[model samples]
Target: MKFIPFYLIFTLLIFVQACGNKQVEENKTQREQVIAVHDEVMPKMGQLKSLEKAALQKAEELQNSETPDQAKIDELKNLASQLNLAYEGMFVWMRQYNTEDGEKTPEEVKVYLDEQLVLVSKVNEDIKAALAKAEVLLKD
Candidate 1:
């Protein structure tokens, strides 16, 4: 019968521990990235509401004008709707997002974080696009 030496067993254990720690660190990094994306756009919620209000008000004024530009009014109204939708999308993401690892394995948590990143990124794009359109419309 062959027996493993104490130093060999100890070295193997250390290697395994190091690998486990590396995986944990990676998962933590991914979680932080997801949170960063969410944070980046969170503060823009108020701006979204303000822009939506301005768009609706401008549309209303155009609607009431004697020589109503129906085309422009329609455009402004559409922009307002887009802004509102984008704002709501953020809330929806927040509601669905779970920060707790719970019983999930590390691989499951990784997959979850990846999905969250994609979802939050989409929300960010929507918000940015709506805001850009609103700014252009309001400027003119």
Candidate 2:
């Protein structure tokens, strides 16, 4: 059997190892971004669904009244604003995750998605808190 040169063989081995490392790094980043996206989106969706139900109920009651309580009206407006903020924030993160640029490096995309996820999650919490308060105010 013919023998391959030692340096050439070593260089090939190093190249293969580097390729594998790169793939592993890419996969780690992808998984992290996916998790972050999940955390942010699900809560926002939950907040929206919860608030929508509460608002619809109040709106229905208002329509039946000659004068809707001013506090309830204000509360509904606030809740609506919160909902829109969350909705818009979700779309922002979605754009990052969805790769609108089409040429963003995977790492850059992941960073943007991850950061957006955190910001959106915080916004979701605010929306949820606002929804809870609005529900009580409207019920009064």
lDDT of 2: 0.64
Candidates' C-alpha lDDT? 0.93, 0.64
Clashing pairs in 2: none
TM-score for predicted model 2 compared with the true structure: 0.51
Kindly report the root-mean-square deviation of model 1 from the true structure over all alpha carbons.
Answer: 2.0
- Candidate 1 lDDT for residue 124: 91
Per-residue lDDT of 57-138 in model 1, one digit per residue for the tens?
Answer: 9999999999999999999999999999999999999999998989987778889999999999999999999999998999
The number of the candidate with the highest lDDT is 1
C-alpha TM-scores of all predictions: 0.89, 0.51
lDDT comparing candidate 1 with the true structure = 0.93
Model 1: runs farther than 4 Å from truth?
Answer: 5-16
lDDT minimum window of 10 residues, candidate 2: 93-102
lDDT of 2 by residue, 39-80 (tens): 655655766766766776676678579987777666676676
